[model samples]
Target: MSTPTSTDLVVGARPDHLISPHGVLDLRGSAGRDVWLSYPFDAAVVVCGLPGSGKSTLLRAWAASATVVDPRVTRTSFEARMPAWLPYASYRPWARLRHMHWLRGELRRGGPLLIHDCGSRSWMRGWLARTARRAGRPLHMVVLDVGAPEALSGQQARRRLASRRVFALHRRGLARFLRQVERGGQAQVPGISSVVVFDRGQRDRITAVRFGSRPS
Candidate 1:
C-alpha cells in the first residue's frame, strides 16, 4: 500500500458546528459543573490519548458534525518533530514548545486552528492552556486515555508489519510514547475539564468510558 497522504492521515475536520454519530452531546454539559462554554465557534479543542486509543477514530467521528478545518486554508504548520529513531521522545518537550510558539503566533494572527495528533502530556497541555488564556481564548481538551500496555502493544505490532524504514523509527517512537504516557499519568496536569477513557476490546473496538465530573 502507498504511504498515506496528509489528507489521508487527517481523519476528520473541525466543522462550523459540532457533529458526531452519537449525536450532538453538549460538551459543556459534560465538561464539568464549573466548566463554562465561552464561544462555541472559536474554541480550541484538543483530542489527546495514548496510541490506538481511538483518538483518531473519535476525531473522525466528531469531524462528521464539524466544519472540517482545511489545513491548506489555515496558516498552520503540522510539525512532527519526533526524532526518526524516537519520534515521541523528541516530540514531548521540545516539539511541544515549538508548537506552543507557533500556536501563540497563530493566535495573534487570529489562529491557524490546530489539531495535534500526539499525546497531550501535562507540560504540553499546561503550556497550551497558558498560551490560550494569554490570548483570551478558551482551550478545550478532550483527553482520550487508553492504558499504556495496549497502546504499546499496538505500536509494536504495527511497526513489525510496516514495510518502510519509517516504521522501524515509529517503533522506537512508540517506546518513547509509552514512557511519556506513564510519566504523564504520574504527574497529572490541571485545567483539564473533559476526559474520555477508551478501553480496547476485540477487533479494535473500544469499550466507551464512563466519564464523570472528575477523572476516573
Candidate 2:
C-alpha cells in the first residue's frame, strides 16, 4: 500500500464539510468517532470493494433511505421467486440485466443515489460519470480497502464466498484501481469528483453519510 501523503491525512473532528481539493480523501487509518460524510443533493455515490468486502453492510449503515442500486438486492428478489434448489449461477445473467435496467431508471431520477459496485468494472464507472456529468451532479467513490484474508473472512461470515478465480480477478482489479488512486490518476476515470477510502477497521466509525444537509 502507498504511504499516506499529506492530502490523505485525517481532518478535524467535525469533517462533515471536508472535501479534498485533489479529489481524493484517504481515511484508511483515521481515528475518529461518529464520522459523517456529506455530499451534494444530487451526488452519485458509488461504494466499491472486493466481492466479499462489506460494501453492502456499509451501504445499509450509511444510505439506507437513499435510492440505492444494489445487485445483491436484485438477485435476492429473483431468488425469492426461483425454486430453492436452483442455483443463482443458473440465472446470473438475467439478474445482471435486470439490475442494469433498474440502475438506468434510478440514474434518470436525478436525485441522490448510492450504488453498490464490485470495483472491478471501469466501464460502469465511466457510465456513471457520464450520467452524473449530464445531470450536473458530482460523482463520488467510497472504497473499502481490505486484504484478501479479511475479505475472505467476510465472505465466510456472510456464507457467500466467491470462487477462487473470481476472487483473484477482483483482487487484481481493486489493486489496479488503488494503485491509480495512489498515483493521483483517479481523476482519469472521467468525471470522478472525489474519493473516500476506508480500511476494514475504519468502516464502523463512519456513522452516516448525509447529503445536502448541515451537520447537527
Candidate 3:
C-alpha cells in the first residue's frame, strides 16, 4: 500500500490495513451506537461531504476493496493537461463535466462501488438510487459532518481550495439532506438502506471501510 500523505490527519489509520484503537469512536457492542453485525457486502456506498472535507483522505486509507470514484483523480489529470499558468478557475466547468461523465459510466457497473461525493449536487445520488433499485443492490452512505472551519482546515492541508460560493452551496445542500434524514427519510430516500453520520472526531476514529459481516 502507498504511504498516506501528511495531509491525512487521521490517527491509527496506517499504511497497513489494520484498525488501531484510535480509529473507532464506538466500540463494538457499544450502546446507543450503530454497530455493524452484518452488511449486504454487495452494496454500493456513496460517501458525501464538502470539498476538502477529508473524504478523499479517509477513503484513501480505508476503501481498498471497493472501486473508488473520486474527483481528485480527474482534477489532477485535468491540471496536468492544462498550461501551468492557467488557473484552475479557468477550466472548472470542463473538469466538472468530465468527472460527471466518468461517474455516470461507473454507475453502470455491477456489484459494490464506493463513490466519493463532493456534495454540490443530488442528481448522481438520484441516479444511483434508481440504478440500485433496478439491480437489487442497496445504496448506503458514510457522510462527514465536519464544520465549515474544519473543512477549510482540510482544504489548506490538502493545498486545494474551493470557492466560498461553492462551499456555501455544498453546506446548504448537505444540511438539507441531513434535515431530510431527521424527518426519517433514512429508508424513504431512494435505494438508501443505511446512513452513517460522522463528525471530525468520529471520522478520525474510522480505521477502515468494510462491507461484509464486520468492519474491515
Give me candidate 2's TM-score against the actual structure.
Answer: 0.83
User: Mind giving the per-residue lDDT tens digits that candidate 2 earns over 1-216?
Assistant: 122222332332223323332367776766645456667777778999997789988888866647888888899999999999999999999998899888777877777899999877777778878877776677888888977888999999999989999899889988888877777545545588777778877777766777774224
* Sort order, TM-score high to low: 2, 3, 1
In order, what is each prediction's RMSD in angstroms? Answer: 13.6, 5.0, 9.0
Candidate 3 regions with alpha-carbon error over 4 angstroms: 1-38, 85-94, 213-216
Write candidate 1's Cα lDDT for 97-142 as tens digits.
5555656675544421334444434455677667667776545444
User: Once superposed on the true structure, which residue ranges of model 2 sit more than 4 Å away at CA?
Assistant: 1-22, 83-87, 213-216
Clash number for every model?
7, 0, 1
TM-score for all predictions? 0.43, 0.83, 0.72
List of clashing residue pairs for candidate 1: 13-68, 14-67, 14-68, 15-66, 15-67, 16-67, 19-65
Better of 2 and 3 by TM-score: 2
* Model 3 agreement with the true structure over 116-157: per-residue lDDT tens digits: 986446776777678767666667777788878999999899
* Ten residues in sequence with the least summed lDDT for candidate 3: 20-29
Q: Whose lDDT is greatest here?
A: 2
Query: Looking at candidate 1, what is the lDDT of residue 36?
Result: 18
The lDDT of each candidate is 0.40, 0.76, 0.64
